[model samples]
Target: MRYRRFGKTEMLLSVFSLGAMRYLESAANAEKTIWHALEVGINHIETAQGYGKSEEFIGQAMRNGLSKQRDRFYLTTKIGPTKDADSMRRQIEQSLKKMNVDYVDNFDIHGINLYEHLDLVKDPNGCMKAVREAIDQKMLGHVGFSTHGSLEVILDTIRTGLFESVNLHYYYFNQRNAPAVQLAHEKDMGVFIISPSDKGGMLYNPSEELSGVCYPYTALYMCDRFLLSDPRVHTLSLGAANPSEVDSHQDAWDNDAPMSELEAAVLDCMNRRYTLLENDRCSQCYQCLPCPEGINIPEVLRLRNLAIGFDMVEFGKYRYKMFENAGHWFPGNKAIRCTDCGDCLPRCPENLEIPRLLRDTHDRLHGEEGRRLWE
Candidate 1:
């Protein structure tokens, strides 16, 4: 496995870190997975209070001989984005007792996805105060946060300089967080990217077309290489529910692979797929923005591309639903809000019938209808 300097906290984190979000049936299963990961060189494990039973399962594994390997790993668990110190303290204590650890190397402010959540942690009387108190007591080593917030909010939180690391999402389809990852590097903060396989376009079960496009390398391996190729990305959270599945992740650990050639192949196929000029696709250029009705036209068109070109109906619906009332996070209006406005038409280089395409974008991915491939 390849390791990278995990910024201010100064640990050499593995490029592929194990995440405990997908703990399987039994404690023994979790124990086996943990042991297998350690044997394979993945030394960082991240878990959270919100992930049901994941903490308890890890504790169970530690109790069953796995504790002997404790020093071989760097442990991190998250707690409250709570409004007060007491709640944070209570959660921290529970995490420690549950994990049966003397101290966690990193304690996270779980999910600070908005300005108010950041406020809860930074309020002096809030979560961070308790976290600092714990650090002083030697029960915690470093403090950080994980977020699913907007780009502006993420950058604002990183700029606070209070964190040793920051965990967020950044992958192929979701390059929206690229700027924040770069900012974290500048701030000397560790960048741990969460759910790269599942959220990075559900790559484990790539479609035939996708498989062909990424020939000589599987889709998941392509994604793993893409994320690891960037210096800003310290590690990717690969969550496995079964011990046998861990081998798939192990296969993705080659740092010396010929990734540039593979990337060119994937991009060559991607460009062809996305450049369609029928009722099926849009160029995804943001030049037609500032829709008079306040709609995210380019974004809608991009999602529209999935349903028509890639036949990724479930993912299209899943993401399309994120726009329902997402406000400025997605910004502008839904496709249904367009009023046949010709304003965007003049700006569009593709000469797409703006209103018609907007309606098509909405109609195709519009309902709660879909067959989810897998989680």
Candidate 2:
């Protein structure tokens, strides 16, 4: 496994770090998986309080055997939308108690999507002040935030010069976040990539069209290679289920042979294919959110783009499943629930016709069922 400097920090972290999102089914199994990763030289581990039982499982595993090796690894966690300063402080204390650690190497603001939330955080009475107090008290080594906003919000956040790191979605398919990663590098802040492989369902298995281009390597390897190709990406956090998954990633990391010309050409072609999906160009800015009805405009649009861009039936199916299983297929507010108020248009970042897109998503995904459910 190769290690890269985490921004300008003195710490050098593995390019592929262990993500503890799915480590809750069995404590023993999670422990074994984490140990195996450490044995194979994966020294950076990331988890979140929002991920069920992830922090507790890591705490249990470390107490069981990893405590001695603690100094050798970099551990990170995050704080989410707290109701107030008191609540935020309590959450951090709980996180510390659950992790069985006095301090986390990196602690981040979890899931900041709106520009308004950014302003709220920076307010003296807001959560950012609480985080700063904690850092001053030595409760966290570094501070940052994780966002799923547009390039504009990302750039604005980085320019605040308040964070030591930032976590954002990034992958071969989602180049939208690339500029943010570059900006993080320029500002000397750690860049943490969250779920790069699973974001666009890329890691599950590449579509046949993509597989054909990748050839010799499995779709999984191609996805990993694509992300690792960018040297600026400090670490690609993976949600590993077992030792085998960690081992597979280890193999990929060890075999960093230069990309073959065919591989480069294939990736180039894929990028071009992705760029062509500009039907309405939503940009996922989420400026028109909290829709009165409950439509997740950006997600539906993304699925629509994926459906048309890849021309892969299975990919579309997977996206449908994601929506259904995650309770986001038809959100309760925004477009799906819009009364055609026309209130969201003037506030939109991309000025997309919100109601129309929601109607299209409903028809495309559920057709008659969606109409009956919403109408």
Q: Pick by lDDT: which candidate is best?
A: 1
User: What are the clashing pairs of model 1?
Assistant: 294-332, 294-333, 295-333
Query: Model 2, 192: alpha-carbon shift in Å?
Result: 1.2
lDDT, each prediction = 0.79, 0.72
- Model 1 scores a C-alpha lDDT of 0.79
lDDT at 232 for candidate 1? 78
For candidate 2, the lDDT comes to 0.72
Model 1 poorest 10 in a row by lDDT: 366-375
Over 4 Å off in model 1, which ranges?
256-258, 277-301, 318-359, 366-375
Question: Which lDDT tens digits does candidate 2 get at residues 37-103?
Answer: 8888888889888887889988898788788888989888987756578888889989989988888
